[model samples]
Target: MTAFTRGFRLHLADGQVLDGAEFPSGRAALVDDPEFGFVTGAVSVEELLLGYHGARIEWDDEALLEGKPRPTADSITSDQLDALLLKAARADSTWATALREAATVADGGRENDCGCGGCDTCAQHRIGLELRRRADERDGGRP
Candidate 1:
């Protein structure tokens, strides 16, 4: 059996506490996954923390699983776990996609409304108003 060298505990807003053991092997297994994060918007420890908080706010406190306390939004899900693993597994693909996107936006062009500090297309600028209009519609005409 493995002995824990450190124990990490997170006190969730819903009054549930998440506890996990930190072993050398576990530390060695920790890694980052981007597509998992991009696809789900949950790629980092902080992102996971925020997701747990969201879940905590969404679920009832009395829920339970297999006699153990169920996770609120504050609890990490198997989906998130799988996302992490998937991100790790598809790291190369994600990198390639990112590179391709970067190349498409090639630097030294111009600037967009948000000023991403990159070049922009005159066509893009001319159509910017229409794009914003559509965005406004999508946002329900909020400012």
Candidate 2:
């Protein structure tokens, strides 16, 4: 187990501990549960994390294992970056487009994911998606 797996942890930025009624580590796993699929589609991870931290877990859910706490904002940022990368590796152009658009908007005198502060990888994801989209369009709608 990594150091993070031992127990409670905090994100480096704000040092908020997601443990002991403050927040829970199982949020990620819970988010994947089919029972909450409807809510998952409607809410973003950031929003869900903020809104549901410390929220009670229904005891009946077998996947609801109380694990570690939430990490810090910095840790979240890192995770977000990783998520972006994973999305890219999986060829998820929607996220790629969104991230690139975010970067472009940030560069073009618009507010970005103020919380995320934009990233080069996001820009790259956007560019890749755009290129692919254009290629598909040029090929008469076949990727």
Candidate 3:
């Protein structure tokens, strides 16, 4: 377990804050409250880093000393880059069409060879669905 000299707060995306959370040996954070003692379960740092499950971590400067450094744009994986581009494409029709066309070509024009709607093999379909979902959200949940 790595203890910080100056502890930091974990500002969660939902507005909940975990004070004095330390980084355990694993890829999780440990919270030891004075009144409640050690908190129940471990908080997955990976989930927070990846912005998964509507949870994202905003690391303060002190937190950087205890755990991994903040992820910059250059550190993100190719898949993450693609997701960001696709997300941006949602706001522009021309970009969205171009991205969809590119994905179709990249996938060899295949719709669903394995019939699994969301597998790595079906890039075009996945991009299409993601774009559609974003559009729906922009349209106030309308399909």
Candidate 4:
């Protein structure tokens, strides 16, 4: 069995100590214990730390996972982009439809002449172009 590294220590008000590690997503993952089995899902490490008031926190800088590069748009895969678009569609159908249409046009090498960046059409076109660019990169320069 692999040994778990203690990256941080949380001293709770009830005289209990918890060991946790910082994930690459900036969230804290508490070690598995009898009461809590590998707790996580906090929005961020700060939020998790802030939740327990009147608690002392200890950090092991060497053991903590920090300074990890976050995933950029270029690093996303086409399937991931499609999943995001699908999620957007589920949230806002009209907006997602417009974006899909704009992306289709962009994929066809069509350009929008609208100079106003704030306009809905222009914004959609820009997002669509970016999506196409990422997709092309993922496809090894093939549109």
RMSD of each: 16.9, 18.1, 16.2, 14.6
Candidate 2 lDDT, 88-129, residue by residue in tens: 555655544555455455445232332434544566444555
Q: Which candidate number has the best lDDT?
A: 4
Better of 2 and 4 by TM-score: 4
Give per-model TM-scores: 0.23, 0.17, 0.26, 0.34
In candidate 2, which residue pairs clash? 10-72, 11-71, 11-72
Q: Is candidate 2 or candidate 3 better by lDDT?
A: 3
Q: 1 or 4: which has the higher lDDT?
A: 4
Clash totals, every prediction: 11, 3, 0, 0
Q: Report model 4's TM-score to 2 decimal places.
A: 0.34
User: Residue pairs in steric clash, candidate 3?
Assistant: none
Q: How many backbone clashes does candidate 3 have?
A: 0
**Candidate order by decreasing TM-score:** 4, 3, 1, 2
- The lDDT of model 1 is 0.41
Better of 1 and 4 by TM-score: 4
TM-score, candidate number 3: 0.26
Model 1: how far is 140 from its true place, Å? 44
Which portions of model 3 show Cα errors greater than 4 Å? Answer: 1-8, 20-24, 32-35, 41-44, 47-52, 62-143
Across 14-116, the per-residue lDDT of candidate 3 in tens digits comes to 6766654335443454363546766533455554345434544544642322355434545757765575567555656555455556655645555455356
Question: For candidate 4, lDDT tens digit of each residue in 35-138?
Answer: 75767547566788777888777766422223322234457467656765666545554444455566777544344544455545576567677766655554
